[model samples]
Target: MGTPFSFDDGTAICLYVINRAPLVEINDEALALHHLSGMGLDPWNPRRMTALRERIHPFGVTLCNNGALSLLTQETQLGWHVPRFISAELAVAQWAREQMGGTEESRNLAEEVEMYLRAWRPHADLIRHPRQRGISGHEHQFDFLQNDELIDVITPHHNATGGLMRKLVDVLNAGDESAPKVRVIVDDRTDPARAGIEMQIIASLAKAMPLSKLLDRVHSGSA
Candidate 1:
């Protein structure tokens, strides 16, 4: 499917995925109490944070020295999911359909989407700026970038940096010639022994072609 909106000028969306934990091992098998209780709003409560942490101690939490130690629910409140999608227009339309329902909401949602796109049009320069970065929660990083066009997604995976980089590289590889380059930052600075897995993945890529060459092709202007 084609993007719903089009821009005569060059407008790009830069999605920045910050690695709060530049160095840490994530216990993916861990399950938080919120997951069991279905505490949608529990994250906002300070008491809940402490209590939840205590509850998950047994399962072991995902540790990221550079990242914050908090429930995933708490991170969503920071508005990090905004830049996840590539197409803002389509995102709004989809959200409108789901949240508002009915024709009136749909119409209103369309107007709002247009308004958002209109406002974003002027700020395209800022959004597309090389340094202009938008921060999002780590948990939502992959989900948000699954589909987007207006903005380029940035995901820095510290725990499994190589796995994350490989997945992102695969996406760019599958993208059309016109797809904007997606940057996946892998923090290789870690204990040599522990960093072996991630380095191994990078090493494999380097074998076929220089790391710089692979990155250049994905980020090439000709793309």
Candidate 2:
């Protein structure tokens, strides 16, 4: 998590991109680079990507490793998806932020992930911070919603997870006969033992998914 370069001017977040086929990023390359963490990228050297190129890990890594965007929306990923008919510039900005993250990043992980999901599936009916009434006639607040799914985001900081289990249990118990599907997006960086125990408690009433796998859950069609 340490910053590797100073003149990076806050660029160089690792991205998973396809290789250029002469004129397009249409094919996947071999695994090579992911630059979010510190290793040995010399900031003052004036030479950057040649070194990054020499160190290229491959497709799962990075090839075109260094550059700046004139505007966030101008950035691209996965080829043909960019500026297709009915294209979304906002989606491109979100993709750019995910790839070339800023120096002063947002601390709101829930909001961040919500935006990520929206960008990837802009046409989906995704609602944020929605309130639904439980069967007990009490209202339950959720971080996100889609169809009948309820997602509650919990973190591993400053007791952020405290009472989440109980609150969710109440919601689950009060759910209707069919019961809406509930998912708890837990921060993956939590302590091992605590996460194990917490996940078990959550699993009894809902799906306990790690923060890192949010998109995976979406892709799996169970988000």
Highest lDDT scorer: 2
Give per-model TM-scores: 0.21, 0.44
Residue-level error in angstroms, candidate 2, position 184: 0.8
Candidate 2, residue 163: the lDDT equals 44
Task: State the displacement of the C-alpha of residue 78, model 1, in Å, after optimal TM-score superposition.
Answer: 26
Q: Rate the local accuracy (lDDT) of all candidates.
A: 0.30, 0.45
- True lDDT of residue 139, candidate 2: 57
Give, for candidate 1, the lowest lDDT window spanning 10 residues.
Answer: 33-42
RMSD of 2: 18.0
Off by over 4 Å in 1: 1-159, 162-166, 178-183, 203-223
Q: In every candidate, how many clashes are there? A: 9, 10
Candidate 1 vs. true structure, TM-score: 0.21
lDDT of 1 by residue, 21-137 (tens): 533222222122212111111232455445444444433332223222322322443343322222332332232223212324323333433333334343333232121121211
